[model samples]
Target: MPDTLRLVTFNIAHGRGLSLYQKFSSPERIRKNLRAIGELMVKVDADIVAMQEVDEDSHWNWNINLLKEIQAVAGYEYAELGVNNRRTGKRPLAYGNAILSRHRLEHWHTQSFGEATLGEKGFLYAEIDYKGQVVPLLNAHLDFRSRKRRVEQVESIMDYIIENAHRGPDERPLAPIICGDFNSRSKPQADAVNHLFQHILKHREYHLYPRDKRTFPAHLPSKTIDFVFLPEPYRMTRCEVLPGFLSDHKPVLLEFEL
Candidate 1:
């Protein structure tokens, strides 16, 4: 049987929902939000889930590892967390991206972008064995403030992908898929979103899925910032924006077959 995988990319906003400040101050609110987020994850039921803005041992979030919490309820056997932002204060803070899967995740690696005033942002790279084939995956979260910063980050990502594409067959990534909260709204006026899209197409030969879906502001989404890109030989059978307020950004669910 051909392998079909259900993938989801979500920015859980540290599981704080809309009450960001309050959720950090009040433990009860954090607990409530986490419970709701776990329920949402189970409902999604993705085979491999990539998350951005996830918390890892942060004091504000009651020092709870948000990815582990979600993995418990989502029934994923393997999970990897990369802390991209770190603070060395009395009450330390760390934020990053994560990947959770039912299959073993190997070759775990992470890349951080150039320094930005807001904070450090990066992507998680790993490989998984699916139906005896090695599949490469990248989960990324780009800068949300400036388009120039996002363009730089995207260029870094593209360089990495292009470099790996030329490696020998024994070392190259097989049928790679990149997905995440790009934070660059889709527009036609030569913006960061289009720049990143064209860069991937030109070098990596990857195509975006569900061209019309909007995936931000989970309550009333109007921006198409999140995306999933895959190369040929991998067919996206279904792609849709899942409706929920589990986080500030709506979760994007993609089903692909190989």
Candidate 2:
């Protein structure tokens, strides 16, 4: 109902922080980390939060459903979980993306990029009812290992958007918002980031948040991999990188007007 919408994109790193290589951590540690992250979310009070590397009933985080905990702590009424990677056995492990929203999330959909070099990754698409406006929202996590794979993933996402969100050339439909950890480094020679940026520019009237801050390695961040892209009719009022090491990547918060 308000004039502006605040959204955040975070990679929780399964609540492991800097110790990402470890198989698992003590229950106490994980709980503490989750609590801290929840408190941060409450403080930020974002209308929607797109998360990456979230665990669902996984042993790595002591079988805790991180998404539920986050939703509860952040006081979000709606949520959608997209499991991109799952291991089936006695103790099944599932990992993927999640979107926690204060608004109603309708017609939610998920798609996987079908076997990349590193692992399976995908995006979560949904339409949020924001003050009577239907806003198409996308939360995505691309392949982290291969640049070529990431480019393909970006192309796939662009195609999905065109098929579902595009309203034609004449109609000025509400431009969709895409947010996530693109995993595209900030270096000038980072072809993946350039390719993805150019691809969006070519396909749609898109605008990206200025790369003025770093998000990864949260404690002493140095890379601007996470991003928020807004197309025409949806302009950002403000953008900030929240300071925290709750996850390996700091949350990027964007306030936009529709």
Which one wins on lDDT? 2
Clash number for candidate 1:
0
**Candidate 2 lDDT by residue in tens digits, 60-155:** 677788888877777899998988878767657787889998999867888888843225889988889886678788889988888888888888
Candidate 2 worst ten-residue window by lDDT: 166-175
Q: What is the lDDT of candidate 2?
A: 0.80
TM-score of each: 0.90, 0.91
Q: Per-residue lDDT for 251 in model 1?
A: 85
lDDT of 1 by residue, 1-258 (tens): 667888989888887877655345466676677677667767767888899988887777777788887777667799999888787666777779999888888667888785442368998888887766677888889888888888888888877877664233586545468889888876754556678778767655777865888887778888788888877778888888888777788888898887
Positional deviation of residue 175's Cα in model 1 after best superposition, in angstroms: 4.7
CA deviation > 4 Å runs, candidate 2: 115-118, 166-174, 186-190
